[model samples]
Target: MRVRYLGPPAQAPDPLDGRYVFEAGREYVVLELHAESDGSTLLRIEPSRGSLAGLYNSRYFEQVSDVIPSLWGVVTLPGGGVLLGPPKWLSGEFWELMMEREPEAEAEFEAVRDEITAEDPVARSS
Candidate 1:
């Protein structure tokens, strides 16, 4: 139930990790479910980013029942808001999937980091 922010400055900031700018001129806020242990679920909000554009470009939100425990449906609010919670059947499915995929996901994430660093000279210098 704990919410964590993810995204660039001016949109989501402070005490949050995992924030990133997916593309220019567009921003998103990613929140993670911290209560889970095996893996975790994410809830993203794209306030001011518009609905159709945000939904198409944003990667922080998805309906992946196989990876999120008990996740059923998401509620979309006005102004590009969203809420994610578990359903009945998929409540524990996420944990199992996360446990199975954590290592691979971590490796993939690290590889992405390395690739980004190699591509961005500024990042490589830092």
Candidate 2:
């Protein structure tokens, strides 16, 4: 998913290593969104450079799109089995993976996706 950096997380100081990572107001493609225990989420943006690394706090970005990060999430397929996505998807690639791996269930998967909704962080600002 895409997101635009807002700055350091609202609840924290600037990351000591951010100079090598995020650029203020820059848009980034998130590599993953990790579900957090505190009802918050963590993001892994495609690295700005190879020198620094760490999952970023989601509070630092305004969502460019919807992304639901939950380890407990479950999607029932048309078949009798369940589709299990990792608690946190890599580059938020779960949907693609599901469609690719379950061609026969494409319509079913999409139907499920359409039935879900997440509050867009960016929209909340407006």
Candidate 3:
């Protein structure tokens, strides 16, 4: 998936986490998306900038293509993460954690999305 960094949060940066020094308007490839039961979400991205590759809250960027194809089940992800998705949209902290922990995250996500779309042409929203 693709996303564009909107810049750091409006308020002061967190004292602990600091701030995300992302280039505003720059586009990044979303390696993985993770959501929380509380409705919070994080995105794993390979930025177009320096070595800031890591997980950042979804509030940091805007989904370029929000669609996440449905289908798939208890899949294995790195960092000991698990995801039961698509129905949950494009956010699942477990999924993004899995994506970062696993080297083949983007490929795996593509495969699942493709497989689901192949079966059901109409799926999740963007």
Highest-scoring model, lDDT:
3
lDDT of 3 by residue, 1-126 (tens): 567777766787852121555678876555456665566666655454333345677776777765444453334446454443443324556356544655465555555545544543232332
C-alpha root-mean-square deviation, candidate 3: 8.3
Q: How many backbone clashes does candidate 3 have?
A: 7
The C-alpha lDDT values of all candidates are 0.34, 0.50, 0.53
After superposition, which runs of candidate 3 have C-alpha atoms over 4 Å from their true positions?
15-19, 48-52, 67-126
Query: Which residue ranges in model 1 land beyond 4 Å of their true spot?
Result: 1-14, 17-101
User: What value does the lDDT take at residue 83 in candidate 1?
Assistant: 47
Answer with 2 or 3, whichever has the higher TM-score. 3
Q: Which ten residues in a row have the lowest lDDT in candidate 2?
A: 111-120
Write down the TM-score for model 3: 0.48
Residue 27 deviation, candidate 3, in Å? Answer: 0.8
Model 2 spans > 4 angstroms off: 9-20, 49-53, 67-126
Model 2, span 23-57: residue lDDT tens? 88887655445555455566655454322224676
Candidate 2 achieves a global lDDT of 0.50
lDDT for residue 26 in candidate 3, whole number 0-100: 73
